[model samples]
Target chain A: MTAITVDRLHKTYLVPEREGGLRAAVGALVRRRRREVHAVTDVGFTIEPGEVVGFLGPNGAGKTTTLKMLSGLLHPTSGTATVLGHVPWERDRRYLGQMALIMGQRNQLQWDIPVLDSYKLNQAVFRIPDADFKARVEELSELLALEELLRKPVRNLSLGERMKCEIAGSLLHAPQVLFLDEPTIGLDVAMQRRIRSFVAEYNRRTGACVMLTSHYMADVEALCRRVIVIHHGRLLFDGALEELVHRFAGDKTINVELADEHPLDPAALGPLVDGHAVERSATGFSVRVPKAETPRVAARLLAGLPVSDLVIEEPPIESVIEQVFEATSAEVDGG
Target chain B: MADVATRPVSGRPDFSKVSFGALRRYYVGEFGASTANNLAYRGAVAIWVVTTVIQPMVSIVVWRTVAGPAGEVNGFTSAEFVTYFAITMLVDHLTFIWLMWEFEWRIRTGAMSPLLLRPIHPIHKDVCDNLSYKVIGLVGVLPAMVLLVIGFGGDVSGIGVVQVLTFLPALVLAMAVRFLLEWVLALSAFWLTKVSALNNLYFSLFLFLSGSFAPLAVLPEAVRTLAHASPFPWIVSFPVEVALGRRTGAEVWVGYLAQLGWILVALVLLRVVWRRAVRVYSAVGS
Candidate 1:
């Protein structure tokens, strides 16, 4: 079933146009003018129940605006959206109780109070039964390793610990749909992985639909099978991660280990050296070659150079996403 | 998402039965949490309480000293002045609405988005928060009330059981009026980014018009006439007047009707302003 349906969502903001200096400030006080900024324009997408989708975009590229609209935190200027077949802005209590929007930057947990107290408050707001509330709290606490943190005040917990509790509080009602905006924005790598796995496990257990937007590609790579790329308030790509890598990453790297201590001269490796970086040792070098030219470059290097060890690997996913953004921007500029 | 069938979304939460239970739980839980919150920030609370009571306490001392030696200025004795200030403290604390904080938050954090998304009106949460503070404030205010009565020699001979009984409903109406008006003011956050200056202007008007600075009787005849029409006097002055037994017979009933009227007007204003604010906020993409 389609859990979320959005069509031609457009959001425009009226931003005040103020110039610098004292004179302009005085003039603004007299007659203020505004410029209309199109944050999200003609964006459209749908998500099926139990599907995990990754939303990717650069900063100020309308990723958050689109997410906010989708989660019903925002209303579109001239489009329609429905979550679980109800208009989000209507803010029906039932809809609120069933769906959760967990933002990393803004915490929902009550500060200066124990995490359990916040959960209890959520229970009241969501009207969760006592038995279900207890069982779910226990389950979420165990999953997030929040056994000790539950008793401590939210203000006392570190960012990572607090985020875990935030996630737990958001889910105490077992919201069918979860909208996570950078759920691991500031966590260390291990904590990020832990959160990613926890989300995957939660999805597996409850079959909840999740739409996550993150700057971290590892989050997308690990948890999301299908990725939706949005840029400049438009959907640029919507497909598998593998296809994204294959389509965007047109190059591979070739690493070599020299038999003896000798630095390779760039003058000698003409036409074959797109780029090369030496390991700390003078005997080793890593070279970047276009995927189509990898075979030729490697063959030439092995035959003509005193190489001992060699390896070829794909570029990182972050590089692929960066390339996607670069390509999208170029296309936009060309148009 | 988990074959979790869509539940009924629009029906009310059984206001007659389950709501009572929910309200009970809400009050108990919210009170406990707020008490802990206030305790956790005891220093800040103490500072705030001191700042809050200073003006009222100072005015009482001034009026008491002015009405010296057998002490009765415009029919209010020294003891009456003490009771008036103490009662005003409790009344002001009860009716206080931090529309300033509410508006700033709705604007700054963009948390208003989620609030606007709920099926229920967001004012319910604000109402809960308002009451939660009072629930916690009772802990400090109760003892403080006793100390003021003993130290300043307040007289409650005129405070009958009927007056005490009527005070509850009167206070409820005052809260309703204040909440509706303040909620309308909070909606300004949606239209304007810098609303603090406007909010300051509002509080200044409220201070003068509400008899917070002085009893409505002390104001000039013209200002008193204006105060009668304005909602502020009805919110603070009428309640204090009734408690002090200053108003009686038909005027007391008139005060009750005035509160109801302001409530209705404020409710209408809230609806109109909220609709416009929602439209503006959604248009601006906050």
Candidate 2:
């Protein structure tokens, strides 16, 4: 069953215009100007129950806006979406009760109250029974290692600890769908990994559909098998993570370690590789070649050079994503 | 682990079918939490109570001086003036709603996003917070009232069980009318970024028309008529007069009917204004 289906969803904001100056400020008092900003344009996707999908984009690519629309926090300028069989924008209580939205930069907990108290408020809001609330809190606290932090006020906790508590509080009712927007943003590497693992484990245990957005490629790599890439408020790619890398990543890197500490000559590689793309160290040198030509180039390099160790790798996912965005922008510019 | 996690919690009811019993429990929980949160800022509560009490105290002193040695202005003696202002203070405390400032802050800081996401309407939480603050502030209000009555030699000989009993419904309706109307006004923040000037205008009109500055009878006939036409008198002056036994017989029943009329108007206005505010907030991206 499909947990979420968004069809041609769009959002446009009417942003007021203001130019800095006393004259402009005074003029604004009499007549104001507004410009329409298309935050999300014709974005559409679907997630099946138990599927974890990553939403990838650079800053202001409309990822969060799409998530907000799906989670019922926004009313789309056009199009429609349903979560767990109910229209999200209609904000049916059943839909809201079954889904949770967590924005990493925004907090839902009461700042002055203890984390446990905030959990109790959520329990009331979601109408979770005492026994079930206790059980879910226990399970989440154990998974998040939040036993001691639950009693402290939210302001007293570190950013990582507060985020863990936020995730825990959002799950008090064991929602069937989770919309996590940049859930690991601003967290340290270790904390990000912990949250990623916890999310994977939660999905494993509950079969919940998860849609996550993050700047950290590691987060997407660890959790999402499928990714949807958006740029300039448009979908550029949507498929398996491997497909994303394979389709957008045109080249591969080959690192060759020489038998001795002697330097390698970039001139010798000739037409086999781009001479400028070759970087030589004291012990080794690395070269980039078209993915289809890696094997031929490796053979020629081995036959021509004193190679002690050789390793081949697809370019890093970060560069591939960067290329995807660059290619999309280039297409837009050309169009 | 999968089985345990996937097992639907027993006794869980559909949102549409949620029982009133469960809703009551939820409201009770909210009230308790709100009260506890308010108690954490006891110093702030005391400051609010002091400000609330000082307004009426200053009004009473100024009016008493105006009465002079003969002690009568517009048929209100010094002792009667004391009684009127003291009751006004208590009534003001009961009916005050700070949502104008709160809504501005919430909109500016993006705090309204989480509220919009919840299954419940945001107004219920705000109502609970309002009541909780009043409940905690009563700790200071009651003592201040007692001290004023003693220090000013306020006369209560005219007060009886009937007046006290009549005051109860008036106070409740007044609170409802003030809260709903102010909440509607607060929705202006959704459109206007700066609401301090609007708020100041509202409070200034309320202060003069609600008889907070003096008894409505002492004001010019035209101003008194205007006050009665507006909802401000129903919120404060009408209730204070009822508590002081100054309004009785047909006047008392007419006051109740007027209070009910204004309350209905306020509720309808709130419903309409809140819908538009949410639409604007959603459109503009909160």
Candidate 3:
């Protein structure tokens, strides 16, 4: 069964606007002006149960907006969505009990109390049976290294520790679907990896559907096999992560390392790489080539030089996503 | 889950039924958590109770001074003034809500978003929190009430069995009416956007008309009539008078009916306004 289905989802904010001037401020008192912001427009996608999907976008590209709608914290200006066979915006208690939405930047735990007490509140509200609550808390504690931190008040824990506890507290009910919006945001690399792996483990154990958004490409790379890309409130791409890289990553880099005996010659090597400028280092030179021509270009470089080491690499996912965003931005501007 | 981690839960509690037992369990659990939270911040709770206690003490001193050594101003002797202000302190502490002051921040910061996602209504948690704070804060407030009464020579001789019996229900009803009224007023922040000035105005009117500043009998006839016309006196002053045996017989029944009427109005207003507020936040993301 499909876990989440979003069709023609749209959210437009009627935001009041005024120029930053005394006269405009005075005039606004009598009559205000408003502008429409299309936060999410006709966004459509479906994820099967147990599917882990990356939701990628630049700032204000509607990633968070879409997640809020699916979690039933929001109702779309227009369109329909369902999670686990119930319309999300209907906010039936059953649907709410079965789903969890965690935002890394915002906290829901009571600040003055121990983290475990907050989890108890969730248990009471979600109506988790005592045995299940205990087992689930134990499993999450073991997975997230939360035993030491759960007794501390949330205000006393570091950001990373609080986040670990936050994720664990959110899962006490064993929600079937988890919407993680930058769950590792602002954490150091080690903490980020821990959270990423915990999410993966939780999904693996429970067969829960997971949709995640993050600025850190490492998070997306490790957790999401399928990715959906959105830009300017529209779906730019939705498919396997590799498919995304293959479709949007326009070029590959080829590096050739030579023995010290082979003197550096930027002039003579210019013609070998289709006359494209060759980037040089003390022991090697690398050339950018279209992904389709990497083999041929590598062969020419190998045949031309006494190469000690040779390497070919695709651009990193971060750069590829930036390229996708830049290209979409250009398209919007041009149109 | 059984495939890997642990056995399937044997008993799935159907909380969806909204039965009385389920509600009791939910509230009991929430109350425990809230009480724990209140205990964790004992200093803050003590400060809150101190503030509640101090206000009535000031009223007592000022009103007693006006009443002179053994004089009676508008039928209120110095001792009777002490009694009225002392009772007002306890009732005010029981009914006050911070929602009117902090709700705007909650909305602007998106702090209330998590509350919307929960399976249970947000008001249930708020009620639990409010009750828990009062329960914990009473540790300080109850003693302060006794001290103020004793220290100020409050006239407790007039308080009879009927008055004590009736005051319990009156105080409970007063708490309900005042909390519901303020909760609905706090929701005005959703549309008002900036509510501090409005909140100040609300508190100012509440102080004057609720008889916290002085006994309604000591105030001018017009002010007393206005206070009765509004919902303010029924919340604090009427209950205080009922406890002091100042309001007797038919007047006591009238006060109860008036409090019940305000509760019904407040409940209806709460339902309508809360429905629209959620719609606004949902339609246009806060």
For model 3, the local distance difference test gives 0.87
Pairs that collide in candidate 3 are none
Which of candidates 1 and 2 reaches a greater lDDT? Answer: 2
Give lDDT per model, in order: 0.79, 0.86, 0.87
The digit string of per-residue lDDT tens for model 2 on B1-286 reads 3237334455555787656876777778788778777777778888899999998889888988999856699988888888889888888898888899998888887788888888888888988888888888888888888788889988888889999999999899899889888888999998886798999999999999998888999999999989988999999899888888888999989989998898888888888887777766742332
lDDT per residue (tens digit) for residues A155-205 in model 1: 999999999998988887777888988999999998999999999988877
Comparing only chain B with the true structure, the TM-scores of all models are 0.85, 0.94, 0.93
| DockQ values per model | 0.34, 0.53, 0.50
lDDT of 3 by residue, B1-286 (tens): 3333322344555646886765677899889988987888788888888889888888888888988997989899999888888888898888888988777887877887898889888888778889999888788888888899999899999898989999999999998888889899999877877799999999999888999888877788899888888999988898898999988999989989999999999999998998788767742232
Candidate numbers sorted by TM-score from highest down: 2, 3, 1
Compare the candidates by DockQ and give the number of the best one. Answer: 2
Report the lDDT of model 2 for residue A89. Answer: 76
Q: What share of the true interface contacts does each candidate keep?
A: 0.25, 0.43, 0.50
Please provide, for model 2 over A247-329, each residue's C-alpha lDDT reduced to its tens digit, 9 standing for 90 to 100: 88999999989898665556667665645388777688898889988998899878878889889999999999999888888
